[model samples]
Target: MKQALLILGFVLFTLPAFAAAPEKSGKSKAHGNRYQAGFTLESPEEEAEPPEDNGRGVEIPTLVVPVFEDGRLLNYVFVSVRLQVADGVDPWKVRGRTHYVRDAMIRAAHKQSLGADGNGRALDREKAAKVWMATANETLGGESITGIHFLTVDSRS
Candidate 1:
């Protein structure tokens, strides 16, 4: 019984000392179900930068059209453009041409023209909380759109 008691006392005192030793370099074991101690490595910032692209393209303008509660683009409005083709051109061909233009406009407005998806396409409530809409204006013979006129349609927000 004396020998057993001595062995028990030795184990009780030595357990804490053993636990204080430094852990091995690689690999870590989580304690219990909660996270306590471990090494986490993130990729270096220099290596995180995206590779460069060499594609050249035409640039389009972004128009911020506000939606007005009453004759104003303050409450709620979409950032978009209404393109009307030049005169003598058939409306059908104009429609076809404007489709690509509108597509480019949407891409530019959403800032998705770059390699990665831009904030415009993101549903994030912070950065690009503003909405966008595309509408093609009808041309009157040679009549043309003098300039982008941001008009308010409806206001609910």
Candidate 2:
């Protein structure tokens, strides 16, 4: 009975020490400063803006260019082009001129030599992209396109 009373007294005395709230330390303030010290907390209402359509761009239909070698037909290359317009530019304005844009792209593709040594072998993608960019800018009467992305280029030989 005396040992039980001692144990009960020891537990009662130690329990209050464990239950007490921890004191703030200088190290805690230093650690907190290392992360997000100068940052202001934003309310939920301030972060509720709608997502912007940054990647909403226009895609042109596939273009087929015929490759020939010495009066003989070789194969055709199918190319898909996408144009990303600059800010404040109306995408529909470019879309409405699809016919002219397609014509310009076709003309540009035809000018590129497919083969390594002009033997009508493969698609000249780099040259085609350059020419297409130039032609599209000329057709649009201004530099409205921010970038030209080639989505696909397939050759059937």
Candidate 3:
């Protein structure tokens, strides 16, 4: 191990290209600065631009729903959802009503199969989104939410 490490150190640090000091020979043009402490010209730093106005969104807690085949329990699929709010609708207001959304989702999951193809497969996203949309609008008393994004649908057996 010591021999191997010594050989590695020799190959790495002793290479003229990898040398940390200014080159004695004029071969320093190929490899840019390899020196740790030596002063070198750095590329210009990029200025951070302000973010564009994307509309609001609300996140709901993940819910676990059972997956079954032929009326027997197989495993659980964890569903995470995020609601995209319509323009002029407050996301925090939707966030405050997330419990209602979460409750409705859980109840709907119990009442119906949200999975597309069972056995560790993805959920039926369109169907699930429909349920979320209808439930959120009904609970919030308006169509405040424009979109339902299924963040994740992981099946565990």
Candidate 4:
């Protein structure tokens, strides 16, 4: 009977501690109330603005160059290039001089011997981009071009 009374007293004392609701503190109320009220904690001035869209740049047509090995044609390399222009440069100006650019690119490709060589070594893309940039800059009358990106380079034997 004494043990039963002791157990009942322990249950009665501990039940209130577990059942009581938590007190809403000031810090938690400030943070949670703002979110609940649909207001963001971070101010709009703290957010970064997106960059401006200048243009899509220019895309050159695909180029085909034949590979030679010891006086015989071995394979052909097909390359598509995109010339990325800097901001404020007009894409129409580059488009207007497409013929000269194409000619310059063809000459550059031929000079570089693009594609597999007689020793079966493949052309380097970095070297090709550098050459293309140089050629395009020379043809376009200035260094308005930011980069020369190779969209596709496929070789067939």
Candidate 5:
């Protein structure tokens, strides 16, 4: 019959697709059935670590401070900083006390302005870096960090 021929044609066309598929190297020996997926849940070979806290240094939350001039409210500058760990200091210890460092830096930044030096429209990187480094060092009670590096400094009016 035509219906039987059509079914035979459909099976002939689809059979090669299942036969051509590579077999899964699972423990199950029942590879005869293509519909059987005897897969077991397997854990990943290794875990991934956070990008910033990979024993290099600690990244503080971005600091958003107001840039003011002559009692006028100017644009806010967002400062992102990273503290490099000292050679002998444990990075985890410094990382654990990061909140203190951030608080001290925020207080210092509130006291000091990070406005432009001579350009009058950009942040003074030199002065800002010094303030951040000094505050972090003082807060950690020793030279817990080698230095403070500015990651980003931008302003929006």
Candidate 6:
């Protein structure tokens, strides 16, 4: 049992050395770009039953947030995102989804970021809408954006 434990300890220590060893291939497939982040878009799920709407706008399903940011109230920052088309989705459709996802993400993030405030929900709605419209008009049309840029706005008095 003592010998087995010693062998296990030796193996554990040596395993990291194997991970740190240099690759044999001179030409690396891995490029050294720190700015890039991985993103995945999952295909839309098949609905068993279609959503029902009573004439106004479609009801956005409420997502239950389990965590909230712990901090003092700071200046509200609005992010103006500009998106460029890459793969499957077209420019116009991508623009629309960008708008939708931007709204969804902002609402979701704000709920977490501003949960402590009494007026958090109200402020997020008003500010997010303004930012979304401004970004859509100014950044979406005319010039084609190659990617996304988020500009922040301070709403603290």
Best by lDDT: 5
What lDDT would each prediction earn against the true structure? Answer: 0.35, 0.69, 0.69, 0.68, 0.72, 0.42
Worst 10 residues of 4 by lDDT: 35-44
Clashing pairs in 6: none
The sequence of per-residue lDDT tens digits that candidate 3 reaches over residues 9-88 is 98886796666567588765677655443222211232122233364867789888765555766556777667788888
How do the residues 1-157 of candidate 2 rate in per-residue lDDT, one tens digit apiece? 9999999999999999988846556454333434222322223353243234466467889888776666566667776778777777798898898788888878766665543346365666566667778888888878877677666656666
TM-scores for the candidates: 0.24, 0.56, 0.59, 0.57, 0.61, 0.29
lDDT of 5: 0.72
Q: Which regions of candidate 5 are displaced past 4 Å?
A: 1-54
Indicate the worst ten consecutive residues by lDDT in candidate 5: 39-48
For lDDT, candidate 1 versus 6, the one ahead is 6
Ranking by TM-score: 5, 3, 4, 2, 6, 1
Candidate 4 segments whose C-alpha is farther than 4 A from its true place: 1-56, 69-72, 116-121
C-alpha positional error of residue 92 in candidate 6 after TM-score superposition, expressed in Å: 0.9
> Which candidate would rank higher by TM-score, 2 or 3?
3
Worst 10 residues of 3 by lDDT: 38-47
What order do candidates take by lDDT, descending? 5, 3, 2, 4, 6, 1
- Pairs that collide in candidate 4 are none
**Which candidate number has the best TM-score?**
5
TM-score of candidate 1 to 2 decimals? 0.24
The candidate 2 region of ten consecutive residues with least summed lDDT is 35-44
- Model 5 agreement with the true structure over 1-157: per-residue lDDT tens digits: 9999999999999999999886676665654654433322212222222235446678998887666676665556777777888888888888888888888888887786777755443567678778888888888878777766666665555
